[model samples]
Target: MCAQGTYITCANSPGQNFTGCACGQCAPPGCDGCVVHLAGGSTLRG
Candidate 1:
């Protein structure tokens, strides 16, 4: 399981990173992390 404060990185969109244990679900297989916030100030988490 991922611990809190875990760093995340997306392959498709490099340079963009986020930190959150729950963010693991947003990331694709083999990736450390993915973008949870989307455009227009909307979030993917909810």
Candidate 2:
């Protein structure tokens, strides 16, 4: 399970079983989505 202020991501593959964590809080209110910073200074919205 993800921590309270962390986000999770996976590569574009089926059954690859890879998990990654991004440092940020899940979107507030419902906390149903996440926003994270990418390596190239971009933001990923999900």
Off by over 4 Å in 1: 1-5, 26-46
Residue pairs whose backbone atoms clash in candidate 2? none
Best by lDDT: 1
TM-score of each: 0.32, 0.28
Model 2 lDDT-worst window of ten: 10-19
lDDT of 1 by residue, 1-46 (tens): 4443444556565876655434545465666435455434444441
CA RMSD, predictions in order: 9.6, 11.8
Q: Best by TM-score, which number?
A: 1
TM-score attained by model 2: 0.28
Model 1, C-alpha of 25: deviation from truth (Å): 2.5
| Deviating ranges (above 4 Å) for candidate 2 | 1-33
**Mind giving the per-residue lDDT tens digits that candidate 2 earns over 1-46?**
5433343333332233223344243333333344453545555665
